[model samples]
Target: MTGLPMEFRAEGLPDRVTIYEVGPRDGLQNEKTVVPVETKALLVSRLAAAGLTAVESTSFVHPTWVPQLADAEDLLTRLDRAPGVRYPVLVPNERGLDRAMAHGVTEIAIFGSATETFARRNLNRSLDASIEMFTPVVTRATEAGIRVRAYLSMCFGDPWEGPVPVEQVVRTGVRLLDLGCAELSLGDTIGAGTPGHVTTLLTGFAAAGVGPERLAVHFHDTYGQALVNTLAALRAGVTVVDASAGGIGGCPYARSATGNLATEDLVWMLNGLGIATGVDLGALVTTSVWLAGELGRPSPSRVVQALSKEQEPDHAQA
Candidate 1:
């Protein structure tokens, strides 16, 4: 919440909007190099320290699909769990859920794309079939008293099948809701959505009785509209947002996709708007820089890049 006044408050907005930091898992999943387990653990710990209420710590998917997350178990075991912060892992199936459960994971996220083409391409299942699979996972998780977050991919448009209809998105979301998902994250998988699309889709969902509290937004920056879209969601009464540190992450199935919305940028916008996300931008920058060092690459977060340059000492001083 850096850059925000102590008494800062957005009029007519909720007391705070919960930011779901997906850096540890979504951000690292698409990396070519394998981030050390220590680095991943440190990222999760740092995110919690920065005051993110919900940090997506890791994914329990097969290592073959996302090699960068091969050390998920190790990373999860090492993150320092804060008392009030939640750590959720993405689990694709029962086996993944089992692995996550064994580590005492209290929250898990299941994903299903809105379009059949994207589903078959990304998840290897039909849209209906994928939604059905989550039913059992949701049932078991509920019985175990674990909260589940379900992701609906390509809610606006898919690379394979363009322009996903509002009806399809609503159907998939309703299915996840029926399966007992605590939240349905609507993802613009390829960054093809605009503010208008967000309004339309959110309105459709609201009409279907899936109110703002039960939804989250996951947007990419490919078209440079993530922030604006986020603002739209906020106006529509949506509270939770999914972002990646340094804007890391991409859809592996969509090779041309850009990074997920940068967490620093999102924090900057929220702080300026007097919306409490509870994230410390300076600490977020440090963590992103650490991650960049681990990957041997520069961060994509504009705020991080600018702030890093500002913080560097003058060459003459050296």
Candidate 2:
């Protein structure tokens, strides 16, 4: 591990940041190639070994919508759930939640959109109707002693709707919270967010009584601003950030959107800033390299690339 610069050490950042690893679930869901259930289980184990306390294992959405994760039940059943580790899965509706419950799932996530077009296109319903749909799911899960994390996607910009208003994001987020979600993850699904936009939205969240403690920021690297936006969120007192190993997954609905913020990249920044994430940067880079090979591609993470290069034996010196 590297030491933090003196200047950054005094930046008043959180002493520890919670990295919610989404590699096995969100990261693999958009892959054109089919990933075996065993590989997904191994990915979850590797993430836990790398000190990721929270790993999203899979989603229970209908296979028709996300064929890649059709093996959600098999993957979850085969996962090696480590002590003190969480493997939350995405439950799209009542049916998904029931399937997750049948497998003894303790944590689950539900997703909504900040824009009407995205809501209709993604969930086949209007913004208000989608929230109503989630009400039963969230209520039932909470009653079952399951923790729920709600994701509000396209919080910054929508592919069809253009820029989304900050107020609308706040209002939707508040509604999700009211429906019994334990935490809300604001997503930059299109990666259209800048540091200024992040700051402004978080400010609105603060005014709406949604403090940083109950919020997580999920950003994509479509525009290469994910890390900058993450930094801005961190500085604003947000501690939980969502990332994918190897930068593998993207929104299948948003054609222009690319891979998510890489776990290795986020750890590099947090580690350098003296923020404890309990993750081993070298181990995480190695995981991404392995996963990239499985997907027959190179990792999109800049940190992973740099670290892999550094680890290569120097034939010139030899």
Top candidate (TM-score)? 2
> What is the lDDT for 134 in model 1?
82
Q: Which portions of model 1 miss their true places by more than 4 Å?
A: 1-12, 316-318
Candidate 2 lDDT over residue span 1-318, tens digit each: 242223256375798999999888888989998898888889899999999999999999999999999999998879888999998999989999989999999999999999999999999999999999999999999998999999999999998989899999999999999998899999999999999999999999999998999999999999899999999999999999999987888898899889999998888788778788999877888888998888889998888888898888999999
For model 1, how does the per-residue alpha-carbon lDDT over 1-318 read when each residue is reduced to its tens digit? Answer: 233334455666665788899988898898888888987888888888888889998898898999989888888778889999999999999989999999999999998888889888878888888877788899999899999999988898987777889998998888889989899999999999999999999999999988999999999999999999998899899999999999999888887688999999888888777787778888888888888888899999988888788778889979
TM-score of each: 0.95, 0.97
Clashes per candidate, residues 3 or more apart or on different chains: 1, 0
lDDT score of model 1? 0.88
Q: Rate the local accuracy (lDDT) of all candidates.
A: 0.88, 0.91
Whose lDDT is greatest here? 2
Candidate 1 minimal-lDDT segment of 10 residues: 1-10
Q: How many pairs in model 2 have backbone atoms within 3 A of each other, for residues 3 or more apart or on separate chains, i.e. clashes?
A: 0
